[model samples]
Target: MVRANRRLLRARYGRYEGGPDPLAAPVDLTEALDAIGEDVMAGSSPERAMREFLRRGGSDRAGLDDLARRVAERRRDLTRKHNLDGTLQQVKELLEKAVLAERKQLARDTEMDDGDRMLAEMQLDALPASPAAAVSELGAYDWKSSEARADFEKIKDLLGREMLDQRFAGMKDALENATDEDRAAITEMMTDLNALLDAHTRGEDTPEQFDEFMRKHGDYFPDNPTTIDELLDSLARRAAAAQRMRNSMSQEQRDELDALAQQAFGSPELMQSLSQLDGTLRALRPGENWGGSEQMDGEQGLGLGDGTGVFQDIAELDALSDQLSQSYEGSRMDDLDLDALSRQLGDEAAVDARTLQQLEKALRDSGTLKRGSDGQLKLTPKAMRQLGKALLRDVASRMSGRQGNRDLRQAGAAGERSGATREWAFGDTEAWDVTRTITNALTRTAGEGGDTTAGIRIEIGDVEVQETEARTQACVALLVDTSFSMAMDGRWVPMKRTALALHSLITSRFRGDDLQLIAFGRHAEVMDIEQLTGLDAQYDKGTNLHHALLLANRHFRKHPNAQPVLLVVTDGEPTSHLEASGDVFFSYPPHPVTVAVAVRELDNSMRLGAQTTFFRLGEDPGLARFIDSMAKRVGGTVVAPELDDLGAAVVSSYLSSRRSGGSGGAGEDFDGMFGRGWGRWG
Candidate 1:
């Protein structure tokens, strides 16, 4: 009898004799955030920024036009200076060449020896005689050479500048005197001339064709530019300006400018080149002419002018008048009531205003607090509940489960049994025996049968069948690491997500299951799922895995039949603890005392028939090895999943364990989920 009693006791309690080891696997969280951060940032609304930009008179189009105008003015200035510089250099080179020619002529005139003449030729050649090089080296040229170059250069510059001045004068006079129609036509012609000249220098059109084309369409260029060389140089300068214009504005800015022009002029493309030219002329430096006045004698000047000269003069004046009119229009814009324009735009104003408001609302709604308000935006109960539901959804998406499969399966040890039968319900299995149903019906009706006829009375209540469902009670304590390291490394968010998901699953799907949440850092504390949402790490502290496990063991002691498990997610190994002196003891690699404390906790967990599973998030191999050693001692499991795969790996392990009847252990589940067999210890 004594031997039999000992055998029975061994069968009942032997599995609790040895404790399970603690396992640690590090989780990586940064990789997951990278995938979704960009999408979130871009979709964030831009309406507010746009509205602010417009309120500052930085409406895209206006800003662009302002930029374009500034760029054009600057380019014109630079081009003029550049042309002046080039002309001076060219003149210097021309002087050098002339001086050399004169030296040769003088040598020949004096009947100098052939040797002297040859020497003079060689000297000139050696002194950077190329026109291009001479100009570039203008500073080094002799004073006489420089002066001679300046003289020739001044003549060309004066001729060009004077022509520009005369053109402007003629345009101004014609605009003041010509008929409105003639003024308009002349403005159009001037615009065409500016565009043609601009296009020609940009290499968009051949110089000869452009000049001929301008003369044919408008009388402005009838003289064919007396010096083709000077004309080519001028064209080069204009081309530089045109290139500057192309580089000055971005596409978006240009589009906005175009829109602004359209609003002001009815047609954004209605610009008259002549009017623009007139504006350019008025903005030019003083003493410039447009008719080459200084270069021609009276007869030559008169001959230079065909019947077209008068027409050209009239056209130029008309363009200048139009330019002045446009300038006046621009000036008047400031006085015109913006309120009136606002009304004309109508719903656009309201939309813009509302968009601005929405932007402010969004900023306020963000988690940050306002200056004067309380530094808290309490989550409404509805949002809290939604958060819980979201967690469950996330977990469910990560876990694989049989959907709508209601077949009852036995899971845990059988308890006291009693049989009960009930009639078939809508969701009941169709496998109920017909014979049994009929027998039950007939038996029930036999006693009351005197009035029952044989027409076949089959009632819904007569259907009966026997079914059984196994009750698998599980007590799981989730030990979340709330260390400062976890928060700093961005492990906290996903950890919370996983915790919430697990809590939701237990509360909603397995309502009868025993669940506990414990947070451990420098110390261990029990917390509820509701409180977990606001869980934050505080102080530089150590993780007390031992304390958490010990507490979990104490909680699970009351559940004699329930299987117990401990899940710990941490980034660092245990580091600090309270000492007998009522002071905290700490270490970098975790002191021997910390390890002893943790080992004792594991021993206690084993003594209570509970398994501990660890999920680590740090990169320390030492921690992993320590976790493996603990798992060996306690017979639990260690999983080190990449941060991106943490959610899936966690859910997969749980599901696999559930399917394997819980006896296959956490190590088996880890292997099933990740395809790598986890090494098991004693």
Candidate 2:
């Protein structure tokens, strides 16, 4: 291990020392899921949250706006590569001037006749009208300038083998620095490929056929597709890309391609073969996206007179564009083209894309969130517990607070243990002290060794159980106001945080605890553990605390032995109440009727012996007085906590309630939660 470490240290990084980072790790599912949850809680839809995750990646601050700028930079680079206006114009000028020069010389010839001059002028006039026609017409004409001939040769070369290479991969390599044998090799490969496709389309091909073809022509297909379907998919995409390239061109460009086909390799049959191959591919994978226009924006035009690489580049961009837009539910994010992304952006961006794919895969496979029967993603129970625990852990970490550190003891239980042993009782709830029970058996069987030497044995008389402290199971109703105001005022996420943190604490620490999430908005409704986590804020204006209280009573009655712990998180005063007719009555300035109905519900909660805690979010004086009066009337605690520390405050209050049974000096306990004075907020 030490030698391996030394070797690793000695390895040189080369040019990568200060270049783009290569140490890209996969995105952790927990972090991505938490970010998704946070964005959802902040009022973003699940789809929007997933897009945000893809764009911003693991960066905490980078948003969609930043991503837009980066994508624009990539578009600028692409524009530089694809801007081929200048070269096409040059091709037009070279052909036009060469033909005109030929006509001028023919007109100046001493032996020229009238009929011949008329014919020369007519052809010269037709030159600019059809550039491709003029170029083919002047193929046999001698050029006055050698530069024009050289330019035409370059254009012909680019149009010939390069275009063929677009349809058939690896044509450039085969045609490079070779003789007749190489050209014959490509011709043979094309014929076989076309034959294979035809056989497959007619339902006459076997897997062995594809395998044999790949074994012979594997270099042309670097994708190394394992199945016939995979090969077809690849071939179809390339063929579609080639077709779309033609579709994107202007009329003059199409004319040029047509004329190039006439002159390519001194063989018109090559174009016919490619056309046949394209038709076969289309029949196989007809669903491929073959339409779309991407604008390459730049101030100046580009010089792309080399080969058909620009066309290939645009085709690749189109393929990547389709891959990045994953729309279906639980789509495999691994299908994203990392190499294309790397080419468009930097290597660093490819790393980020890989990480995002990892995160998406992890989320799909984790089974924490599953698609419901209605095809909507809903969190499972396991997801709720996982997310809740994370939130609770964050709250606990923040509890160290301004004091730098503090010892946190497990809160006191309901009943104390006698710390004595007893013979097995028929109906005891106490935990058995395994060590003490074993020792009792050993003492009883001190001299009773048999075939199994020194094996201690005891009958029912010697079995003893130890007593530990009895725990209290509380029925908790976390009342989160899911009204528009909570969302507007940036209090929505904090409210969710408080709920998750408290739910996790109760479920994990107090095993028998019964926690129900009551989301109150226009009307109150009881949500299960998972529903509360993914619940979006409603656009309703009312805060119907009355309905929430009614449901709390039902839960308490159901769990008769459990203590009722009511925790209300809201940003506004009661704006609505439940009417006797089962309707929700909304009011602005707190109607006397609404206030009366709310107070009546509070009275009912007090009668049921609920240990209430009102967490006021906003600092409106009217709202503060309302919560204060309600807390005083119920003999409960009122905490007006800052949004960030709300979770910590609620958790501290619950722990204190467990220790003191919701009585004694609770104010000091909440103050110590943040290691600061909470008397001011109150």
**Per-model TM against the reference:** 0.39, 0.66
Residue lDDT tens for model 1, 1-682: 9999999878743322132112312222122122112111122112222222323322222321232243344333333332112222334445556555445464555566777667655555565644333333333333333344444344333322222323432332333333546545654655656665556445475657655654654344343454434444433333222222323334543343233222211222333342355444333322223322111112221211121232233233333233222234222112322232233324344233333333334333442212233533333334344555654554544332333322122111122222545556434443455777887667767866633456446678788655432245677888888877887777776776667667666665556667888988877888876466555445566787767776788877978787777777887888876566656677877888888988887888888777667787777888888888987798877878766546545555544444344576765543433233323321
Index of the highest-lDDT prediction: 2
RMSD to the true structure for each prediction, in A, is 25.8, 11.2
Indicate the residue-level lDDT of 557 in model 2: 82
**Deviation from native of the Cα of residue 121 in model 1, angstroms:** 64
lDDT of 2: 0.69
What is the overall TM-score of model 2 with all chains considered together? 0.66
Q: How many clashing residue pairs are found in candidate 1?
A: 35
